[model samples]
Target: MKVKLYMATKSAKQQASIIGLLFAIVCFMSCQRSSNNLGVTENMEKDKTDVAEKIVLTDEEWKRRLTPEQYRILRQKGTERAFTNEMKHLGKGSFVCAGCESELFVSDTKYDSGCGWPSFYDTVDKNNITQELDSSFSMKRIEVLCSRCGGHLGHIFNDGPQPTGLRYCINGGAIKFQKDDEDNK
Candidate 1:
């Protein structure tokens, strides 16, 4: 009787351990799936509204309006090589969307993040840009886009200087720098 009781108790404990592990795994997977689904749904809704308000261009029109490099980054959501873009060193200029030429970032908000991209603490206006949750490359990021044309600009991060503590890390190929008149003096 004693031997049987001991064996039964051990078996119950093992079953409990297995149940706990399985529960944990299920919870983790559920949370991941929910979050990913939420991001997709939210972006879809936002994009629908944004598309209604902005210029809707066909692929041929976009290809004609943008240069090859600009089209890659803006229309195709491609990233430019780090440290190879001239916009990173631009001074006293306003950066406009390469797709629609809408004003996006000002020189005053630009900062050197040393991340081989044009970093900004702020934008020309909140209405000029849209952010969507991007889960590409097996990582999650907030993707910035031009509000006027829905062009992919880059990603925004939280690690940045004071005031906003937000970094708008933009691809140079996605924007055009127009020097401020004062800078020419």
Candidate 2:
């Protein structure tokens, strides 16, 4: 009976060790994939400046220019609560970068993705935005930034409506709406 109990305990310990090893291996592989997709070996510095016509400001200047929440999302890459963003329901206007006021998405391109964020099928100009591979939270995503100010806008995904087949899931806090005057009249 004593021998059986000892063997059982040993088997449990071995199983736990195996599970732990498998978890570690999974984590390692995930990280490896993320790293590979992050374009670490590429000339990221050169690529960053491809959209070089952008606004540059000091931290203090940005803080002064933006509200606390705006600074958090635009500068710190933070996301606002879905369905809570005021800009999600905006109509008939252009969405401009909160950091640099660069025209990003037009109203026609905006669509209800039902993903709790303001989704756009396209931007006003490709040069108005920049994309980088984000590997945060163990997820590989394409991060979109304001080319003018390099502020974090949000992520872009391939699953979107036709014409572009790209969904620009933008942070509402990262943009400000400019309504057409005719609509207001």
Candidate 3:
């Protein structure tokens, strides 16, 4: 039907009822949408979830937040030379996000595959990385990225040396060395 708002005086209980009714009406109206709008929304959401990376940044901002090596590896997806990662020391600690400083790999997940890059048996959680099909090379492969900022981290392979058959061969320059502070005690 129709809704009307009046400035006329009314009892407190009536006024409260009117307010509640208006709220319900607003909620109902907001739920209505055209089919075309729904289709467009579905497409938009699909595109967003597919490859909407939040790693976009100004050149200056990127430079300030990362070292030259880190910037090159993360933004460019360039791999560091074999045997150059500081994590090679095998220190115990959280392997945090190189871009946003969020923890993506814990010390327990870290494992050595002897392929040169620091590999992980598992990520901190599924929210930690985005996996996508990569065919840039002649071969098809899976490229792994930071889920939070979408920074290029590395690749995951089914072949791994461990109890877990999966290996997350992350880019060395894409991670930072944060030794566990508790080790000092």
* Backbone clashes in model 3, listed as residue pairs: none
Measured on C-alpha atoms, candidate 1 has an lDDT of 0.78
Q: What tens-digit string does per-residue lDDT give for candidate 2 at 1-185?
A: 99999999999999999998986666334323323334322323323444447678899999999999999999999977666787655669899998888899999999987666788999998768788878787677778888878899988776678997777888889999999888898
Output the TM-score of candidate 1. 0.71
Top-down TM-score ranking:
2, 1, 3
* lDDT over C-alpha atoms for residue 51 of model 2: 42
Candidate 1: worst-modelled 10 consecutive residues by lDDT: 32-41
In terms of lDDT, model 2 sits at 0.78
Give the C-alpha lDDT of model 3: 0.67
1 or 2, greater by TM-score: 2
Candidate 3 residue lDDT tens string, 1-185: 12223334345568899998996555323222121121211111111333353556787888898999888888777777656677865568788778867577887888777667778878776666777665554445567777767678877776654565667778778877677888656
What are the TM-scores, per candidate, against the unseen true structure?
0.71, 0.72, 0.66
- On the 0 to 100 scale, the lDDT of residue 105 in model 3 is 85
Question: Between the candidate structures 2 and 3, which one is better when assessed by lDDT?
Answer: 2
Encode model 1's per-residue lDDT on 1-185: one tens digit a residue: 99999999999999999998996565433223323333322333243335555878899998898899998999999987666788655678899998888899998899887777788888887778888888875756678898888899987776668787777888899998999898788
Clashing pairs in 1: none
Q: Which stretches of candidate 2 lie over 4 Å from their true place?
A: 1-52
